[model samples]
Every structure is written in C-alpha cells, then in structure tokens.
Target: MLAPPLAAGELERPLVGQSEAVILSLCTRGNRLPHLMCCISIDEIDSLAPRRDEDSSEGKVAKISVLLSVLEGIKDVPNLMFFSATNRLHMMDEAFLRRMSGKFFVGRPSSEARKRILDKARNALNPKILKKLVVATTNFSGAALR
Candidate 1:
C-alpha cells in the first residue's frame, strides 16, 4: 500500500519500497522459521557511516556499534543472510565488512553498456526530440535520468 505524502507539520515517515514488501511477505509465509535476514544496501551504509570530514564529525565506530546492538536484539537466529554493497568498499570498517561475509564491487558501466543504456533511454522518450535530449545528458546516472 502506498502511503500519502507527509503534511507541512508532520514528521516524515520512512518510505517502504518493494523490497520491504517482499521481506514482509516472506516473514508472513514462514512464521515458524528461526532465521534473521538483513539486506543493507551500500547507499544506506554510507549514510550510516559517513566520512568524518568538515561536514560531519561522527566516527564509523559509533555507527557500527549501533548496528551491532540492533542485530544483537534479534532472537535466536541460526541462518543469517546479510548483504551490503559499496563503491568505496575500502572505506568501510574491517569489522563491519567481515559481518557482511561477501562483498561485491559495482563499477560504472563500460562504453558498450553506456551506449546500450543511452539507446534504451532514447527509445523510452516520447517524440523524436527525446533522442536529442538523451544525447545531451551524456554520462548521467540512472537516478539523474529520472
């Protein structure tokens, strides 16, 4: 179910996306399963443990401590599936990375992939002028395209 946007004075609610829905459904179906699964994306991890620069002073250790506490609260769970991604994999704390079990780097697309993506974007645009617009937006990310 889609939630209504927040009003002027209301506190913002965390938006639940399709992944959250799928996880909920799985939990409902396997009520007896004694397993805890966590899937934290790289973007989320970065937000939680941002670099200590001029803009932010919080350390990565503090962030990892909080995450560990949350995981510890979960009841007996034999099977754990934790997933995380990051472009800056080296920046993450060694302890936190170990908990992930596996790490994968998702590099920017190659020339061929970029060309294919551009073509697909051009096709999706209405009117012939969209092709030119897509061409103008060279080297933009998928999110930027939207």
Candidate 2:
C-alpha cells in the first residue's frame, strides 16, 4: 500500500517521539502493491528541525540526528517525495534546509481572498462590518484572518 498523505500539524507528536519510524514508513511499499508511490507533507518544518545551535537539548539534538539519518537512508527511493513548509526559514537547521530540493514563498492572501474569508462569517458580522474588516486586514495571512 502507498503511504497516506500527512497533513499540516499531524506529525508533531510523532516527529518528537518516533521520527525515524514516521519517515521510514513513507518509503515502505506493501508486497501486494510494490510499485505504489508515497508522499509526505510536513508543515511548520522549523518547529520540528530548528537550528542545532539555537536548540541544543539532548532530546532535540538526538531527534534531529535520527531524522537526518532516516532521510539519508531514503534519499535514493525514487517512489518517495517530500513537501515541507515553514514561515520561519531562518530558524530552521542548515542541514535540513540543504536536503530540500526547492523552496517557494507564499505571501499573504489577496484582497479578494480576504473578502471571501470574511464572507465565511457573514452571519456573525454585519455587511458593513465585514467590508471594514476586509479593508482593515490588508496583508493578513489566511490563518490570521481566521
């Protein structure tokens, strides 16, 4: 069987306690479907792998070491892929950053998108208030709007 997609915030606990196993599972294939591909998406990557110099706790350091080892072991697995995102790229480990194949920036939501976001609460907010909120929330992220 192919690995299931891991959504944002889903891997936090496992990444602290069982990171190696979690990563290894991404590259495994069920005997009945050996050709199936796997994908793993990790959000807030900086939380899981902060810079070694900034956080030197024994557990944190050990977890990162194990995570890097598992990733290295799976580097040649053609059927496996990873996508990770972080708002604090500067706070992330340099070694972990090196392992990423590419990076992209996603800016704050546009005015139209922000309007739609406020529209979700149309029942709670009067039309006048919603319009004001949309204009007031310029450059806000979707999460911040929520």
Candidate 3:
C-alpha cells in the first residue's frame, strides 16, 4: 500500500506511454537517485496495525505483515526514504510506534510566528485586524493562512 504511491507519480507522468515494467526499471535501477516516499493523512494506521483481539481480518494482517517486512528490510530497496503525517495521533496503536525510527509533533504556531506570517502576507491593516486574524487562526496551518 505504502510502496505503490512512491512510484505512482513517476509512472503517471507522460513519458510517451512507457510500460510499467520500463518505468519501474528506470525508477528503481536506471538512475542512481534516491527514491523519496511520502504518505499523508496517516490517521488510519491503527487499522493497518490492528490488534489480534480487535477483529483483525486476514487481509489486514497480510498487509501489515508486508508493510512491516518492507520497513524492516530497508536494505533490499536501495536509497528508499519514507515520511508520513497524521492529525489523529492519540488513537495510534503502540505496536506501530515501535517501528518508527523518529517522530515529530508540529503544534500550533506562537503569536510572534503568526505575526511574521501576516507580515509576509503584507496585510495592510492596523493592529486590531491583524490581532483578530492571528487569534482566530489558532490551529490553522501556514498553508491554510494563504
């Protein structure tokens, strides 16, 4: 599941209607460049790593096993790097956390940071309007501000 999208973009690109085998060979072997893998909105990871007692299906177990196997056997795939994001982290399963090499918590921005963003946006308003925008956008991300 995680591996497919890594090559999806490359394969989807219009390379004069190249075959999947040719594209895979080019991405995995033709060049020496590293493959950048990313998976966003990873909130459903618990379903992927469901507990044995929690109505886990055979298909889920198989997928989880394959994902873990791929993650564990990183050496087999040359220069493979992965990243993921999630908004609902409290619901995450402990077993999945153990497999992660690192984790980062990007919380809400500070007042000063918000002000700087507003400044970059060049909002030609007085203090009151600026303050309102900043305070109202408590949990808003930088991208959302634009």
Candidate 4:
C-alpha cells in the first residue's frame, strides 16, 4: 500500500510495506505467475507535491528516468496485472500515469449511493440510528466508511 503523506509540500519516499515487497519478489523470482495479479493502494496522491528547487529539475528528471527503467524491466515480464488505487488522480506524473492508460476514477458517493450504502449498513444497527449516522457521513469515501 502506498500511503502518501496527506500534508502538502511533504516530500517522503513511497512506503512499500513488507507484504508488498514479498509479493513483488515472488513474482520477480518466477515463483508466482507474474501474469496473474498485482495490487497497489495509493492514498492521497494529490499530496505528493514535487520538491521545490530552482536548480533541481535535472536531478528530478534523472530520478524519474531511473524509475521508468525499473518499470520497463517489470513490464517486460508478461502476465502481470498492475492494480493501483489513488484518491488524487490529478497529482500523478503524466509519464508514469500514462502507463496506467485505462484508468477508472471512483469519486465520492452521491446522495443515492449513500442511501444504498446506509441501507446495507443498517443490518448492523437500529434503523433509526443508522439513517442519522449515514446522513452525518455525507461525503465520506468507502475507505472512511469502513
């Protein structure tokens, strides 16, 4: 899971948890079928603001090039299904984002969706209280709901 920091102007490295590394290693080693599946969860992509440096453009470009090379190496291995989830789609790098061409944008739920979701959650609550809680969480995301 790539839990990018929520604060603006915070430059932090992407966090790759242990489980993610193990899965990637398995796929790279040919122990697991590379074409089967790969999953990534990235939260708050919009918060990944680039570092501000007048003379660092070349450095940033070089770093991006290195990352691209690594991605290319992975792509050469057929059968991997890369799944990435991000709330801030607009914050991604154009070049890197392009690789995920057929992207799906899942935004905040509408009032109707909230109603349906409340109906589903109602099973665990008293009917009167469920409606109140759902109404309070008007713009909550699915993750927040969970």
Q: Candidates' lDDT values, in order?
A: 0.44, 0.69, 0.53, 0.50
Which stretches in model 1 have alpha-carbon errors above 4 Å? 1-32, 35-42, 50-62, 69-76, 124-146
Taking the tens digit of each residue's C-alpha lDDT, what string does model 3 give over 1-146? Answer: 33333322333333333433332343344125445542322334554454544676555445445445444554234454435455566655455566677888888778778878987796687888898988988878877776
The predicted structure with the larger TM-score, 1 or 4, is: 4
Model 2 per-residue lDDT tens digits across residues 1-146: 34554543454453455654554454443222448655666777777788997549765676566557555543345555667888899989889778777889999998889989878856588878888998999998898898
Top model number, TM-score: 2
Of candidate 4, the 10-residue stretch with the lowest lDDT total is: 4-13
* Model 3 misplacement above 4 A: 1-53, 74-78, 119-124, 139-146
On residues 41-104, what C-alpha lDDT tens digit does candidate 1 reach at each position? 2344544443444554333344444444333334313343434445565566555555554566
Q: Cα lDDT for residue 87, model 3?
A: 57
Worst lDDT run of 10 residues, candidate 1, spans 4-13
**Candidate 4 accuracy as TM-score:** 0.50
Q: How close to the true structure is residue 42 of candidate 3, measured as C-alpha lDDT?
A: 32
Q: Give per-residue lDDT, candidate 1, residue 140.
A: 69
- TM-score result, candidate 1: 0.46
Query: What is the TM-score (0 to 1) of candidate 3?
Result: 0.54
